[model samples]
Target: MALMITDDCINCDVCEPECPNEAISMGPEIYEIDPDKCTECVGHYEEPQCKQVCPVNCIPFNPAWRESKEQLMDKYLRLQADAK
Candidate 1:
């Protein structure tokens, strides 16, 4: 599943650099996550890096977007190997 930033987001910019997949970004004000680029850090880290650094705890799973572990891992690898 992809993660999203809620309105409660403080725009602290803490989560942006922490994302292994580079999914988070600065938007008009709050930070945003691209679902297509999000893999929940499935193959990159033990846990979601964005959620860990968010000061307001505004990052939450996007219920509308869901994918299996294998699919997420595939996405991770594709990004990982893109520079190869």
Candidate 2:
């Protein structure tokens, strides 16, 4: 699943840079995750880097954007291909 930044986010500015897919960005009030670009770091790291660096633990799996590991990998591959 893609991760989401909750309202509980402190806006510490740590999570955005950690996202390997460049999915996280500043919203009107806080950080937001783009479900289209998010891969949960499946192809880049063992864990979601945004969640790892988040201080408030506001980053959580978005049930609305649920995806399997294989699906996440496919997204990662597509992202990599698009980068070229």
Candidate 3:
């Protein structure tokens, strides 16, 4: 599943660099996650790097973008291919 940053985000700028998928970015008022790019670290790390570094614990699963592990891995692979 893709994760989203809530209003509770402090904009401390800690989570962006931690994302292996490069899915986090600064939004109008806070950081945002690109669901199309998010893979929950499926093919990169064992856990979500953004969530691990977010101090306020504002990053949460995006229910609207619910995805299974296989789907996430497929996305990861596609991203990897695109990067090449």
Candidate 4:
């Protein structure tokens, strides 16, 4: 599943640099996560880096964009391929 930044985000500018996929960015108010680029760190890490470093715990799985582990991995592979 893709992760999302909630309104509780303090915009401390911490999560953006942590994303391997470059999925997180500054939104109109708070930080936002791009679902298309979000792989939940499947190809990069055992855990979501942004969530790990988020101070306010605002990052959460987007229930609306639910995805299976296999799907996430596929996305990760595709992203990796695209980079090359």
Candidate 5:
């Protein structure tokens, strides 16, 4: 599953730079995660970096964009290709 930044986010600006896929960004009121670009750091790290650095624990798995580990890996591969 992709991760989402909840309203509980303190906008501490810690999560944005931590995303390996560059999926986290500033929204109108807080940080937002792009489901299309989010692979939950499956291919890049053992865990989601944003969640790891989030001081408030506001990042959570997005149920609406649920995906399996294999699917996330596929997305990560696609993203890597696109970056080239």
Candidate 6:
């Protein structure tokens, strides 16, 4: 599952650098996570790094978007590839 930041986000940007997948980015009002890129930090970390660092606890599951484990891994791989 990809996580999303609600309007509760303070735009502190603490979450951005913590994401191992580079899934988090600054949004117009709050930070946004690309579902195509977000992996819940599954392949990268023990937990979602953004959620961990976000003090406001704005990050929550994006029910509007969903994917399987394989799909998440595929996106992680693709993001990794793009980084290279």
Candidate 6 vs. true structure, TM-score: 0.86
Error of 1 at 39 (Å): 0.8
lDDT of 6: 0.86
Q: List the residue pairs that clash in candidate 2.
A: none
On residues 1-84, what C-alpha lDDT tens digit does candidate 3 reach at each position?
799999999999999999988999999999999999999999999999998988889999999998999999999999999999
Off by over 4 Å in 4: none
Q: Which has the higher lDDT value, candidate number 5 or candidate number 6?
A: 5
Whole-model lDDT per candidate? 0.89, 0.94, 0.94, 0.95, 0.95, 0.86
- Residue-level error in angstroms, candidate 1, position 82: 1.7
lDDT of 5: 0.95
Which parts of model 1 have CA positions greater than 4 angstroms off?
A: none
TM of each candidate vs. truth: 0.93, 0.98, 0.98, 0.97, 0.98, 0.86
Residues 1-84, model 1: lDDT tens digits? 888999999878789999888898888877899998999999888889999888788888999988888989998999889957
- Candidate 2, residue 50: how far the Cα is off, in Å: 0.6
Decide which is better by TM-score, 1 or 6: 1
Native-to-model Cα distance after best TM-score fit, residue 72 in candidate 5, in Å: 0.2
| Residue-level lDDT tens digits of model 6 in 1-84 | 789999898888799999887778877777899887889997788788898999999999999988877888888888888888
- TM-score-wise, the better of 2 and 6 is 2
Cα TM-score of candidate 4: 0.97
By lDDT, the better pick of 1 and 3 is 3
RMSD to the hidden true structure, all candidates: 1.0, 0.5, 0.5, 0.6, 0.5, 1.4
Can you write out model 5's per-residue Cα lDDT over 1-84, one digit (the tens) per residue? 999999999999999998989999899999999999999999999999998999999999999998999999999999999999
Runs in model 3 with CA error above 4 Å?
none
